[model samples]
Target: MRVRPMLLKAGGVFVLLVLASCTLSGCWDRIEVNDLATITAVGIDQYSDNLIELSLQIYTPPQGSSISMQGGGSKGSSSQNQSTVISATGINFADAVSKVQEKVPRLLFWGQNEVFVFSHSAAKQDIAGHMDYILRVPQIRGSALVFVSRTKAKDVLALTPQLRSSSADVLEEVSNLKIGLAMSAGNFNIMLSSSKGTAIMPSIEIMPAPEGQPQKRYPAITGCAVFKDSKLAGYIDDNITRGVMWFRNEIDMATATIVTEDQGGIISARLNRGRTRLKPRISNGIWEMTVGIDTREILVQNTSNTDVAELKGTRIVEEGLKQEIEKRMNRTLQIVQKKFEADVFGFAEAFHRKYPKIWNKEKGNWEEIFPHVQVKYDIKTVIVNPGKRTVPTNRMEGEKG
Candidate 1:
């Protein structure tokens, strides 16, 4: 009996000791926040003599006194100066990053990075090389938004805007608004790796500040950069970009303005919701594609004297809206198909799904066949609402229809 009791006490003491040892062990990979340079954005450019330039936007915390004073105690000062831009050059992307690391006092950390930008020259020459480095990095997030700058990408990072602390914040907020196609690093990689190996990324440019304003310039996401075979092919304006969006079934929101000749005025409608469908068919060995668009819009502004609440008035306005949409779609198709000869739209995927046997045989020559593929459009538009008033308040007596 005495031996049994002693054994039980020894076992209990061993269990306690194991638990205490677990709690006493310290984390081996722990890093203090104060010793890190948290990167918010990255920019890449091509330099002469086969070199690469890397730029980083690192967040810098305010002084201790400034922090305490602005910590809910004061409203006059703002935290707009929280980031700084630094640059370095090397033979390749990784080498350039290493050189940048040598210059930075603290360890460069990319876990907080939100934006990646490439200059036009860099994008045209070796965007794929840049992307490879970004994908292989363990600390970098795959969801970081990507852009191509018309000017030197480093210039974009150096901008100072009154609304946001850094250019990265402004670009990220705008991307979320769905005004244009929002693509991340992962999304670009997938698109480039697909069967077609074609992709598009939002393009940014510097817009001069308003005349007589204190600020020199601001950055704007204006258009798209189209890629063919993982290389930059060309760029398109906002109007053409929207047309591409329509074919991809990616339009989140848009506004259209139509002028009514019969009513002698202009009307504006806001797109509420929209959906697109692509039907692929082969007739007598000829590839034909029919695009169907179903969209709903609300009349937000009626400058004409026509009462859109009436059925006849609504029908007239609806027809005009349909024609306007058709025109945009046709123009976009002509440009992407006939002019650019690139299938940024995933028409190849649709064909692959419907006719796998034929797709496999011709997948290699899709580049040649895509430009000749006959396309047709069928669009339907409905006027869901006519706003608060049926007619314009500023309508003249003679303008009434």
Candidate 2:
């Protein structure tokens, strides 16, 4: 009996020891929230003497009573005091980033970065060289939104807007709306590695804030920056950018206005849904592409006397919309092919998909042949809804016919 009691006590002590050891083990790589300085945006610019300038928009934690119980304060107020911009210059991107890190008090964190902007000048140089560090850094996300600024990229990061907390917030919001082609770092990398090595990224420009606004400037998606051979080739305006978007089948939402001679006014329609099909054909040693667009739209505004509710009038309006779309497509195609001579539309890929053997033979001289590649447009538009009033409110009541 004595031996049995002693054995039970020894077993209990061993169990207690094991439990204590397990409880004592804690997180080994724990990092305190206060020790990190989160970066919301990054900007790259070209400096003199072949140097690179790196700018970071670091999020600043609220102090004292500035922070609210619900977390961040009002959107406008929070962003006004929420972030600070710091810059450093070096011979390369990584070097500049390292130098900037030295000045920051806390550990610089990029996991939450929302926007990355490159200046027009910086884009003209070797973008691939500067982009290598961004791709190699495991801490940075591959889906971070990217842009090219018409002015200094740092200026874009510094802009304060009335609607959003920060410029980064504005850029991200606009990109989500699909106002322009949204390109992420990961997708851009794929484009760079593709056979054509052509890419298009949204371009932003600073504009004056809305009247009576406190902020001096705001950022807007103005156009697109075209890249060839992984370097900035040129820029296309907003209209041309929309055309490119149509060719790439990326048009999610847009508005088009057409003037009707018979109606004696303009008719505006909002694109509800759209799709594009590219057909590549080789005939008689000539390569040609046909772009087919099928779209459904809603008649939003009608200044003309045409009764869009009637089948005959609706057909006329539909025909007018188709002609307008075709005109825009042809204008865009002409500029991109004759002027830029760049294949941002992925025509090469279309050809490769249908005629791989021919593509391989012409791949070397795609640049020379792309300009000559004939393009055709087939657009079909249908108006799904006419607004509450078929005719404009401004129209005279006597002109009901």
Candidate 3:
């Protein structure tokens, strides 16, 4: 009995030592930072009918004690030109990536990449196919911003940014401002998988250089690319993109400028906040959607002679603003809804939420029903502030003490 107890204790001690040793062993596949070629952005283009080209913008760290200060720095400043572009062509996204890896001496790392630019031709070919590899790859982040370039994406990546560290940095800043349509990789996938299978991505193009200043060029977001059935349908200009933002409830910062009828002067108002609601109803088997917009704006500039201090004058200005907004929205609807037949405004999702069983039975017919769906708008705008000046500068003489 004594021998048996001693033997059991020895076995338990051996097992405990083995478990402790396993815990002390760190990751077996750890990669060193020095061996990594960290990518900041990725650009995709169609090289040929069946070949795909992939470009990577990799970050280059500043060489020994050469950090450039913003106020004054040498032409060889580290902050100015820190990224380099490398490209390779392959049969598909994965194959292209492998080719790029073979060319690069260091191991390609993707954790820092936050921007993906697709050329118009590549996007038209089938963006969803590219997105499939992106979604499955564990290294690529889901929140990466996606953009469609008016020109070749590789060219866009090659252009150096004047303000930011790299082209990717500039694109990320633009997306953060919400100046136009900004779609994330995951959100785009969700949109494509939605009931109607429609999506939109911001469009970027190189800004035209001024005469005699060919070097002053940069990528700018000018519009949006519409996608239907996982293919590029068409594009919408900036003005129409704003209207789309209103319909999608994605408006963050907006300026509505209108020419007042009373004074024939322009007045610009900045949106303080805005909300949109979509109400779906079925009447006699007819699908109808009512869009309600409630917004508050502050007058930023009043070049009109109208006395906005008075109640009557304020109402008139508000009416003009309302009309301006409606005009843009109507134009957008005409092109996106009636012409392109794209349900990018989430109308299908709204209807499905409202009527689940009916949606399930009729989801397949959403594309047919979308273009003809009756849409009514209820827009209400409140002028929260008329700025520090109650009366316009031109109408100061007409003000009473």
Tens digit of lDDT per residue, candidate 1, span 75-165?
4335446779999998888999999999999999999998999999888888888899999989989899999999998989888775778
Overall local distance difference test of candidate 2 = 0.88
Tell me the tens digit of each residue's lDDT in model 3 across 144-255.
9999998999988987766767778889998899878888999999988864458899999988765675754679999999998788888999988999999999998999
RMSD, candidate 3, Å: 4.3
Enumerate residue pairs that collide in model 2.
none
Clashes (backbone N, CA, C under 3 Å), per candidate, total: 0, 0, 0
Off by over 4 Å in 2: 1-27, 66-79, 212-214, 394-400
CA lDDT scores, all candidates in order = 0.88, 0.88, 0.88
Give the CA lDDT, 0 to 100, for residue 390 in model 2.
66
State residue 357's C-alpha deviation in candidate 2, in Å.
1.3
Instruction: Give lDDT for model 3.
Output: 0.88
Candidate 3's displacement at residue 113, Å, is: 0.5
Looking at model 1, report the run of 10 residues with the lowest lDDT sum: 72-81
- The weakest ten consecutive residues by lDDT in model 3 span 63-72
| lDDT tens digits, residue span 202-248, model 2 | 99999977888656588889989988888899999999999999999
Measured against the true structure, the TM-scores of the candidates, in listed sequence, are 0.92, 0.92, 0.90
